[model samples]
Target: MPTQLLSAEQSTALGTKPHYAILDGLRGVAALMVVVFHLCETHATSHLDQVINHGYLAVDFFFLLSGFVIGYAYDDRWNGMTLKEFFRIRLIRLQPLVVLGMLIGAALFYFQASPAFPAIGQVPVWKLLLVLAIGCTLLPVPLSMDIRGWHEMHPLDGPGWSLFYEYIANLLYALGVRKFSKTALAALVVLAGAALIHFAVTSKGGDVVGGWSLEPTQLRVGFSRMMYPFFAGLLLSRVATLSRVKNAFLWCSLLLVLVLAFPRVGGAEHLWLNGLYDSLSIVVLFPLVVWLGASGHIARPGTARLCKFFGDISYPIYITHYPLIYTYTAWVSATRPTWQQALPVALLTFVTAVALAYACLKLYDEPVRKWLRRKLPVMQ
Candidate 1:
């Protein structure tokens, strides 16, 4: 996820810019859905029957938001900023939590040794630390280095795969894509959208879900998943005219939840049906939601505070929640508990994830980013 909208303090410290408060709130909404999606995933026998089926699309939505935010925040500033400076600013915004997420994963690594993650118990300390070190850098490990048996690029934190792609998108933007003419960028988006549809509809599973691995097929899924939404958002930012919409945040958030929580479109016999749904949602619905969100303004103090809280915790929760999920998944797999049995713990996990994320944000993320900006005067 790109650090799309900055907090009031951050914007003031850097240079004041108008806030997309509703977009920030929508991001927080998506991030929470991702947690719920993963929690519900532990109970799913397969993706076909998974609860919050399209929650994976939140990552795609994030890419879209990232593109819009990057374009809005930095597209014009390149005249004054070097590529290295841009990368450094991004790293300062993103890398601190990435390191903390990996650290949390490593701290809880041994606790999650149930049947669900059979390999965790057997991983040597040296090897585990090695992965931890690499994961802290947000670099993808090879499949041979898969210590969790899930074959995730970063076994310590599976979601790091998306962040890896986030970095790639940032790199591409800095290197050349940022310089593309509007027409050129739109053409690239069309091609990328075509690729996304092809992968989603034609896949054996009929979903664009296998991007965490390093294999060729997975790599295609990864790139296809990233390209269209990011560029589309970028394009939208450059071209779309904003009109103030009343209750836009509520309407957009509800739209996001409806699309994301909508049930599987076609069941076992018609896999491509869900793929088509996936493509449509990403290609059409997400951008609409983003446009509406961008058009919104916070009209009340209570609503404004809610949006700010959600925006502040959004990234931290997304990056750090999965480690808790690893433990919860292990418990579910090993125990096979009924919903009644698991409800309390599930609620606890949700609450704890939110609490921990907020704690990390206030205690670590804010302070570290502040220190970095101070040390690197160029960021200021």
Candidate 2:
């Protein structure tokens, strides 16, 4: 692994700004926050749960950061890189570890249903097939055939839905159709309008369906919402880089939008208060977070190595932790019979998630990333 990332002085020595450490650090922070949120939900810790509920907003943060990172990382390649090469790199980075997580989740589900376990005496063949297909394709469809259905199962992690949109954003970027200013702007507008409509339907006490609801319109709307923020991020990246004034204005505008927008869109009472926090997390926090990550303060004296380590494993942890957390919760609920009694189990789940995440990074993610880089050779 690369040691401490380039500092300002080091970047100056090299005659350009390196990608920001502060941003990666923010990613680190975001990942850990999600972990805490997951654990809190499992443990039924009201205090931590309230504080960390905004962690889902980190999905938007990730999406925005993806826009910024993709722009910054590949700015040079815009004219030169082929769509095929773009996808090859992207697929290799995402697929292997995600597949592993899905596989593990399937195994656990199967184990729960196994005759040997006795607690669960073999799942229906149709249920097994649904999970197998979903895991193998790495494509999530809101199918009705699954045991828990789309609403109840979560297959791997419910958050895994975001990755589907993330890939779609990447694919759209690769298509070169978005390069034309007029076309890009129109597409973004349409996408944004669709997102607003979806938000309205959901937030205004309308019965808007979604992936969880296993309704096709809802699923499409859900996917559209993810796309909008990503495009917004892209548009911001483009204009913000042009001048300091524009950057400030863009940031301010985003803040204003969030203030005027989130309350109308986030419907649940549980979500209403945290909704603003999560909204600003992406709209406002992303730029600031990126700035901090790049500043090299992440590795400062007081920062814990364990947190950084967790940050390193954050992606895998996100992918794998959900099932374990759920299973752990289920086991505790069955055996110990109380939320208070489940606390220790939740803690154990946290530790196990960290360990498994590290292992995935070491055994799967890092090697596959290296292999993809060599095989694709986009940079050279």
Candidate 3:
């Protein structure tokens, strides 16, 4: 809760800023895995499909990583900085590219031969602008523009739903809930209630593996499902501050727990079961990630570069992938006899997503972030 210790740690590290490369590499792995999972939705085998569905668990990883990274980066700032400053820093870091992606996406929808958008004469200009405006801001405008469920993109950006949660989570953290015991307790209670709700909902539908029946609405509810993982990370941040393991066996045991809990490549029968698996996965992964970070593994030259690069472009890839995937799939479907008939389309879509992510990172994300940083200074 005090600022002095954190400030000292930061100053000492700044001569060479603490590099969390392993975490970055982990991020790259997570993002790419999600892409593969989504791509394989149509053809993957039972075991593989089970594991692939678990790919959605990557969102948990992101939330955990966010908690750890924010704690690592701004713990010092937290002690001294006002809530406004904290919020401003997050905006500067996260908002610009989001806006750019939405604008570009909107344009693509406007001109493309897709049925997703209204024709020029019939365009609801004010409604469209309103969607963009609210979307570009921190507010979650799901029902405002008749956007009812998850995956409803205003023409272009599909990953917008996750961003909504990310923003909300960040706001709660910045507001100093992370420092409050009551906040943490409340989070746990909410998570328990959510787990119960998921169990009830999933059980009534009957337990069948193959024909997945969770609605888009059910999946949307899963977003609230993330608070558990986030708090778990917070709890681990505190746990990590304790005495180190006395033996290699202890660390090994922790590692084993993590792996065992990971939703075994595709085994969960329902969202509730999935939630249990995910919670275990985070608990296991969080400590390992922290230990790796603290031990200087992330600072290894090659590993550091890989992590930093992925972490930088990770958001763009997440936000832009659906459109890129859809567009690529559509083109392949039109040109070829059967889109899924060719393996090349999947590979091509992946390559294109990575390329566009890199471009967005370089052309829009970094520059706008820097400009915003200059425009609204973050307290040191």
Cα RMSD of all models vs. native, in order, equals: 2.5, 6.9, 6.7
Model 2 steric clash pairs: 20-294, 21-293, 21-294, 22-292, 22-293, 22-294, 23-293, 23-294, 113-122, 209-218
What stretches of model 2 exceed 4 Å from their correct place?
1-17, 43-51, 111-122, 125-130, 150-154, 176-214, 241-281, 291-311, 372-378
Order of quality (TM-score): 1, 2, 3
Instruction: Write the residue-wise lDDT of candidate 3 on 262-308 in tens digits.
Output: 44432445544554554455556545654544443322345445556
> What digit string (tens of lDDT, one per residue) describes model 1 on residues 82-111?
888888788888899999999999999999
Q: Estimate, for each residue in 54-116, the C-alpha lDDT of model 2 and write its tens digit.
A: 445556667766766665555456676677767766776677777777777766764443221
- Which of 2 and 3 is the better model by TM-score? 2
Ranking by lDDT: 1, 2, 3
Off by over 4 Å in 1: 1-14
Candidate 3 Cα errors over 4 Å, as ranges: 1-17, 42-51, 110-129, 143-155, 181-223, 241-276, 283-300, 329-340
TM-score of each: 0.97, 0.73, 0.72
Query: Which candidate tops TM-score?
Result: 1
What local lDDT score does residue 243 receive in model 2, on the 0 to 100 scale? 20
Query: Global lDDT for candidate 2?
Result: 0.55
